[model samples]
Target: MKEDAVDGDPFTTRDVGVAYHAYSASGDVTAPVVYAGSGNPSDYDWLTKQGIDVKGKIVLVRYSVPYSYRGFKALAAEQRGAAGILIYSDPAEDGFKKGRTYPDGPWGPESHIQRGGIGYDFRVPGDPLTPGWASVPGAPRIKAADAASLPKIMSAPLSWRDARPILEALKGPDAPATWQGGLPITYRVGAGPATVHMRVQMDDKVRPIWTVTGRLTGTQSPDQLVIVGNHRDAWVYGGVDPSSGTASLMELARSLGALAKRGTRPKRTIVFASWDAEEFTLTSSTEWGEQHARDLAEHAVAYLNVDSSTSGPDFKASAVPSLNRLVVQSARDILDIEEGTPEMLSNRLGGGSDYTVFLNFLGVPIVDMSFSGPYGVYHSMYDNHRWMQKFGDPGFVRHTAMTRLWGVMALRLANGDVVPLDYRASADRFREFIKEAVQTARLADLPALRPLKAAADRFAIAADRAGLRIETLLAGDPPDPAAAALIDRVLIGTERAFLDSAGIPGRPWYRHLIYAPKATYAPEVLPGVTEALEARDRKQIALQVARLAAALDRAAAILDGSR
Candidate 1:
């Protein structure tokens, strides 16, 4: 390495490194390294003003500050004609800046690296070659080059320690004040002073993924299903990721078996799934969902997904709006060791986990949860049993509490006469979604929005009537089986009613009109409308609005028993 290569920035090269990020193009290149701040569009806009271009350069970007995923950063760089991207974690985002360092506290050490896939799973998850179908043996497939979710540029992960020299080598304008990282050097947006060699080789191959599914057939309605799921795969050992959730699920399953042995069974079937290859591309669950699409559409009552069940003690959850009350009840039922109340339920379901296919693609009601906190060693080797025992979950009391909550929630869904789905929350959320969509688009005169609002209002009315009927049944003697079945049938169709076979515009595989990731970690509200707004096309926006209104009216009709 030349002295001028780093501009005398002192950094010790270490042996610690991660696998080339998934989907990163295999490459060997030596090119000038450019700092693109966080690689967000705004940063690119600033670079344009300084007459800096990233084409054919390897762009250095920090892990999200305002919180965009690494895949988004890579996509942004590739779109700018950058040959490759290196995403490093700054202490300010995930290390010493947050709290004490590892060994003393839960934050990451200087050498920690985050390993993740860089696929545009937000566009379409599962096997990229088989977009709308299962990846079973001999299944129909498409060329990898044509896969929408595949990335075309090289990408890798870096720790701040490894990145300091390159950043210091930059001889350009100081970065925006907000772009300054925790490293001591003056942060600069550089397209010069640093030239480096980078090589990545990956065995990009198609393989089979397995999803292990088990069922406890119901004593009564065996067709109506309550599903519980957790990913079995991990980036590393994944102690605090799926391991915690898996252990809890195993205990829950064991308890369910014990109950069944004692002749006690749920009124509706309970299905437990251990999904494989979630860390790869959300593979197994997505494929399974595609394989059993018709059965799931007809039978799946609700889905409960647990990922990293107890990283700390802060309980957080995301759910479809209709499941709001049920989730709230479960949260209230669980007695956390720390007595921390669950955070407000976020209705947006992100595509980062196994729940994506069920909630977004299949239009099944879903709730995803975790007991998360600031351990900071996420996706690294340090995210292991020692960390979980010492910091993530001392004594594993939180883990036990999670199992209790999960079992209770699943039992409630399975034992309830009418599946316990309350649509008032859905109505309220739809009303709010329309207002937000209108405000987001800044189209006060959008005609489709008016019809959308009308549908929401009617849905609310129907929801209120159904709520009254449910209350009456619960207060009096046990309702007749025929009456309960009628209401349950209608409620089952509520989520399915939101599906549009055309999907959110171009991404037809994501059939749910109501929810999708929309190209980020967290799910966005009114994904179709949001997609149109992102495209800045008024015609598409109007078309999306009309479609959404129709879906809402259809849901309203189901709730009103007029479907």
Candidate 2:
């Protein structure tokens, strides 16, 4: 609170103030703040069995339990019947030994609070009114009550300054070490022998979502499309989580748009989207893509996601393996980092922010562009303009760099003689998926297990065979147009192969290779079919990989023959 700490920037101080303001405005007061322990689905059931009504009640829960995002399950609890949810981060997990807190250093301070929605479920994401289909204005709307699911309203952070008052009031047995936190008091899971009350009221109103788009139409294959996007929204002054990355995206758009204006249009249409509601689980883009699903699948060459960038020590990318080489080539052109390979930069798919809908449901080959700048101020009041300016990107150099990279990749995809989708890499990745499929099958019921395993084995063989052929084709030379188109179509078919028209167990709208059960903080609501379908889909995926591989091989043969 010192004058010098203000740093002469109004946004920095304002962001800090805004963080406190959000906490004060959203906190609940009337209901007894009972502890739901971990806040999982089973916890909800246990509370019900104990005759404790969570509906119309304010529940206080801790973060860093079995589930990183407690809001997801808690929101589902609210739908089942709970009034308000308050999630506080225990000091034990993210404080002290982890490093210094904000103002002191980077990690969240004692007073810092993490505010987020409990709206996103892993099942699917988009306009609630139109589940599987698009949400066009005149589209028939599903009633809110009839809507598939409800997320509990909750927020969290790594602080005891914000948690002290609530934890002091609760009375219960000593918490297990796993449940214990850094707080001075003996941790206890309580429905309150002390009996604190909590109350919450939200506007529950829909806000206008903005999606700034710029298009570059290709000359040779105008209908074939390639899209790249980044989100602009943040919890507070999200200088790190989104703004940093979004700025890069805007730079890319400017660069690409400038190129088109200069009469250097690509061969396929390229679009850039600055999406809204990404913090709330990709609400804007998912709805837009879902609405335009058919058209998108038909024309979409690929979808690239650029999110959460910073002046990092390193650059990382997680993309559909098929595009591994392409991403690497592009990144090396733009960045100075030595860890140059796309395969090196790329990581696995897990829950956090965007890219869920595109890859999980729609089957769009998604590439998550990430920049890990230090993890000191993540989800804290310190994650403001000041932090970014000081430790992040002061000169906006990285922003400019990423923009250029986006332009290069978009141009490559749009203007290439053939959509450069490499199926050998795809086949190789599918083979890895077979291992995951078997793991999934092992978790299934006995009746479904054998069939699933059989399917997985079949897929494993197909993927291995096809992957080898595709690699051979690529190693040789470029392929004929027809063969290339076949490869492209086969890549496209991989996405559709995993979709079940019947949808996930509950929510039907999301159909893709992976399953994302809707969760609050982790809201990429895509559901893969049951364990039984795992093997079957595994096999189907291999077949699709093979199909693309064969097409690419044929194309290579034809190109060689012609030569």
Candidate 3:
């Protein structure tokens, strides 16, 4: 890899570096560059509308979009006949436009490059060679060349400073206003005079990675499980990414250990997991989940994930609706370290972390939380303890707060007689999703969504009645273990109802009907409906819609104790 000189001097070790996609095949090529804004699906469509052909070119895209969406961009570029892909972080989103540059503030500097894996994770996330199964000792393996999720072309991350010369040399029409970034040069969609060479050399071989697990057995319901996890790997130092979460997990384990020493063990089994290779492709956790699928499906109650636990002070969370009430209650109980007030957790759903396997594949109710502020030095060399102490959490208060929140939530889930899942809230959330899906589908002239709306309404009624019955039972004297057990069965089975054993179209690994990660602007419920509609496959749209309705019906029947 080569980069332009800066300040009449070539790049030193501090300024010159590259981050490549995992499993990127070794290659050497030189081609003209094309600027595709954000490299989203719509952005590609925009490039088409502007009559710019990226075929046989080196594509340049900004890293403003979600990490889950980055691979889609690379795949899209490959399909369009691109020779290679270069990704960079624009100052508009994470640098000077947001705040001061790094060395002065928390934002990224021109030399701070964001590096990450470029696997097409929305299809399947794990070791590329071992899909749909655990990568265990002597496991059945496939050839690395046959792994469909790996990138078909070379790809790397570039610092914006290194990218400026190539971008400025391009000759093309001015980009749409929104396509313009915070760079000083005039942005253009390029097929350029800026030809450049690219190469990615990687050793494709299986290696050993460890997932550290610590278990505390329950006193009464030893079979019921509550798991907490954070990945241990990083692109570089990872101070604000996994390391922050890793520190919080360590603190949580210590706290829980102290509590256990005082004879306060949880009522249900609690597991603490520090996963490895998550930055590469969610390898360790996914493999572990696959290895223990049967046990987890039967015994696991919930999974709480803390990735990048604190970059700031605001409390943010993403979870399945059944866990919403528990998360809110937990947040309200913990005071924010910076604000000195009860934290208010905000909910959204999108996948880019270790929660994928537990939530999407296993149907285990999961929640991921972080106390995030302005974190711009993501995946860069600058994300070290020095940066963390100076800009991220000076007093480590946010880390302590995250530990408390995680420990308290795990304790509640493990010890509560009546599992704190709220199906009524799930129903309400489903209704919202159905309404939005219907609105979006109608705009696209899709009529297959009617049945989904009807099913959501039916499910809502059943969920409400079930919620009332559970509340009444909880209020009764000497909580009936049998009744509580029955409710627990229903709660656990509800998430499974959304699973389609055959999996989503094109992406068989993600079977959940409610949530699946995609390259969309916002998370969609019944994701297959939108995907099918996008493909203009009326038959597939109808099929997915009917299956979603059937799943909802199944959930309702289980909650009503009819199944």
Reference-based lDDT, each prediction: 0.82, 0.59, 0.82
**Across residues 456-519, which tens digit of lDDT does each residue of candidate 3 receive?**
8899988988888888888989788898988888887788888889888888898888898774
- Which ranking of candidates, highest lDDT first? 1, 3, 2
Arrange candidates, best TM-score first: 1, 3, 2
lDDT of 2 by residue, 1-563 (tens): 11123345466454344331121124465655566766667666666676666665566666653346544645554665655666766656555546775455455556556655554445556665566666666778777656543443434332466567777777655545655667777765565654554434445555567767778777867777798888888776788878888878777767777777888777788888888877665677877787677887677878888777764646677777657777888877677444354345543455555566666666677677766654545555567777776666667666667667667777777776556666456545544554454455434333433443444344445445544545555564564556556555555555445555555445555554443443533323112423324445655444433333333343333322311
Off by over 4 Å in 2: 1-9, 15-29, 41-57, 65-67, 76-83, 95-97, 152-159, 328-354, 376-381, 394-397, 437-486, 515-563
Tell how far residue 382 is off in model 1, in angstroms.
Answer: 0.6
The better candidate by TM-score, 1 or 3, is 1
**Per-prediction tally of clashes:** 0, 36, 1
Which parts of model 3 are misplaced by more than 4 Å? 1-18, 49-51, 65-68, 336-348, 443-447, 520-522
Question: Model 1: runs farther than 4 Å from truth?
Answer: 1-18, 65-67, 336-342
Worst 10 residues of 3 by lDDT: 4-13
Write down the lDDT that model 1 would get: 0.82
Candidate 2 — worst ten consecutive residues by lDDT sum?
Answer: 16-25
TM-score of each: 0.94, 0.79, 0.93
